[model samples]
Target: MRFSLRSCLASLLLAAGCSAHALAPRSPGDLCGFTEGRTVLLGNLVFMMAGKTTIQDGHNEAYVKQLYWVDLNTTFNVEGAIPPNVLHSTDIPSSAPYESGGAFFAAGNTVFIYAGLMGNSRYDWMWSYNAKDGTWSRAQVDGGKLNVDHRFAGLSAVAPESNLSFFTGGWDKPITGTVVFNATDAADTKWTNVTRVEGDDAVGSPRIANGGMDYLRLGKQGVLVAFGGYDISKNGTNQTETDHDLRPMDKINVFDIDSSTWYEIEATGEIPEARSAFCTAVSAAPDDSSFQVHMYGGRSRFRENATSYDDLYILTVPSFRWIRAPTTGLIPWTEDGVGRDSHKCVSWKDGEMVVFGGTPRKDDKVQKGCSRNYPPIRVLDTSKLQWQKQFERTTKYTVPRIVSDIVGGDETGKATLKEPEGGWANSKLQSIFSQTVARRPDITEVPIPPEPTDPPKSTIPGEEPNSSNTGAIAGGVVGGVLGVAIIAGIIFFLRRRNKKKNDNSFAAATPAAPPAPPSMYPDQQQIPMDSKDDAYMQLPGELHGQTAVPPRYELDSPIQSRNRTVFELDSSARER
Candidate 1:
């Protein structure tokens, strides 16, 4: 067998092909109906805000302002008893729908839903949902009128220790500033417009909306990092112009809460393309020493031909480094034509990230078509960079009654509901909302095995015997053939010499030849006077008219002997 470079490369490619399939994304099934809603992670539950309820509705689809949740600690069979773990509330207030441009964040035991479009009008009302009481309350803002230009504003909790929540940069009329809301004291909240300082040259603050923003504390200083959103600042008209078009901003904006200074940082290393309406979350790095901002799918642009990404990326804090996350599993939409944008994602326990409902980017011809089918809820393990499809429900449940219908009164008013036919304790809805925390065993990091090393090279000469043995075998065969040819040539030469000697003896015993006839020209036969005596000797009659030349002989040369042996071998081979 012969080894070749091409053969080696081909083998490597074949191995790589097998590896790629092993790393391919996968899905268990659809979790629920597609939604373009907000999501928050609390304990083991992922609470989804308002979203669409169908899979294939065109432009006429309606949004569901209801609250739904899935418990991560328990894996329920989709066909089994409607898992009490996965359920929704039919009693949500109608004024707050978790609509597009709305912001939701969790602080301590309570979740806050801030400024977003309720119906056609944008509202700055801040609503809070108490997890302990399972009730919602509206907060009153004292700083003038609550800024209503907060659609798609970037919102983040000021710090884990503080009750302050910060809202920055939004549109319909994009606000170029930051607003702070104190959950402890609603009257203490205020908004600060980002102002340009004289003689200070830096990248200007971004006027963006629908971008992902989060707060991180670096060395006791709180920093707000915002990335990828729609920017309408370049439009020549005012923010109210209906003809203004939105474009994705590629630069990342960071604000220092302590210094009140802003700096724009250019990201490097597999930076994601400009996108908006994407979901983002903060997770611990693989080393668990620092944190990284993990961002998932979003719309690439705001055009009719805009495409949604199913990729993932993470930006390391402090260093401001961008790393494209290595992901393996059934990627959403590759097999189902369902991509995600304007969705919500949250960091789960054990370095896991959960992605919930979002606007399903479909292939329909309608502009921004929303799929009626619910996209599967995907959980990604950051340590392993692997995605698992946990829940997917095929059968769409009946749309639950709204608060108004349940109360049999006006939609604007709060409704108190009597327990259904069964007592409150026996109702499945009660079990769903009961304040039970689903907890799982802590997931410890698995140690990775070290790669193997090649065996040491042989030190002794010819210790690798395969090649040496092949060479020896070839040399021995050639020497044997040469020895045989030499032996055969000696035998033939001796036999021929003996026959010649016998013929010579016989010729000497035979009769002598007759004298030559008299020359026709006797004068021409006389020897020349200038010739030597030996040259004038008589010649045989057969050689009288011919000139004789001496024969050349090659003698006693090893090269000649070797050449003779090879020639004889070749001749013998031909005859055989």
Candidate 2:
């Protein structure tokens, strides 16, 4: 091994008490490096957990079990400004290995990742990432009595108001086992396996995997609308047996958090085709009249042919209609048609949806000239119903036109057509929505709100009239939120750098030897990437008795790996 002069100089600077961060070449805001996985957006910051990122190229990849965040405050998924920043963590991999395909949720200022594949094995444990201090720790799930083994391809969504997170419908489990956790008070947070909470039967589905779920708050009722995924082949015992069938987009389930019950409803309009291993983002009406769930890029595993998708579907609540949104813009999607799966989508502010991390389906041929080398984020303006290249700081949220036609809103997405007297759906389930949702026409909310202050501007390469060039520099652009934030953004960046230099609390994780690298690219759907991966996870019964700690891996090149493996949970050290 040889040390370059640059490395020697960096070492010397460190010895002379120079800041390692200051010596390292980085962007002005100290933007983070990008990694794909289930990412969480708390306001303007996007947090990413364990997933696969190309260390060198597409073929040379490593499984990451670390926490990374990117500042979207000053960026709108633009090319130059936003990048992943290492939030600095205690060892998170040594205790919880394997990466991605788990159920990730955010409540309060914490991010919770549950049941990701660890090594070849999996765990049913719940891991939380603290936003204040970048660190990872596991919660004592169900007071350590619940004995569900580690599983992947699951779905999770958090209701921040209630401080509750729920997980359900992964592999093997046919939509059973709904684990709920309340992190309102992190120090003594509680986890409840809704399946075993009482003797009652939990919500059931056809062994769904890689589905899309997002929360919509209506008054006191917080509902998670989950739909579309692979329906694994199951037996009488509800155990996943063989391959799978793509679940129909029409087969939707609405989990009402307040009632702890699920309502099965079919949506109308131009419905989307059946698909799975997809992601979802939700933008709701301020008055809770409706929620537009933007479902994007997913794949379907049929018999022989594995197909990928790049279309957008908006599912509107109350009206319960599925509007197959158009993808006619110059850049309709980020990855072309290369089968987006296991990715994550979060609503940015009230206007756009930001997508991150996802591996293309194995059979889908590689993209034309593009890869993850560029920005790994995709922004979609759900209201405008168009894909965009960059985010604009809009003063308000807009409802999509077709959605407003049914649900009715006062804003830009306001209904163009008058809603019928009885509303969209029939009487069968009308009570559910009527009781929970604010109806149109007579509904006290705004009838037709004002349009955006300016004609909404985007930066797509070949976008039409209102669009501008993607090459437009971030600093030069004015109006909306950034209209006069040059000095403020600058001040924020300086304060961030200053804090990093003075803060000694983040000095805990310094490793002597790097961990090993994970070579296999595990599918979130848990399809046998290889026979070894399949066999290693085939051990029958639930993991009982003592908790099994997963073996951690490092990058094949330690230079890129997160050296630390253990992180102290903010609350307790007991790993239950």
Question: All candidates' lDDT scores?
Answer: 0.45, 0.50
**lDDT tens per residue, model 2, 92-146:** 5456543545556666556676655453443445666655445457765445433
Residue-level lDDT for 520 in candidate 2: 25
Models 1 onward score TM values of 0.53, 0.62
Cα error, residue 512 of model 2, in Å, equals: 48
Best candidate, lDDT-wise?
Answer: 2
Candidate 1 ranges beyond 4 A from true positions: 1-31, 42-45, 55-61, 71-84, 119-125, 147-150, 153-158, 184-205, 236-250, 286-289, 302-305, 334-338, 362-374, 391-576
Lowest summed lDDT over 10 consecutive residues: which window, candidate 2?
567-576
How many steric clashes does model 2 contain?
15
Q: For candidate 1, lDDT tens digit of each residue in 386-463?
A: 665443211111111222233232322222332222233223223222221122233322211121254222111111
RMSD of each: 41.9, 18.7
Indicate the residue-level lDDT of 449 in model 2: 18
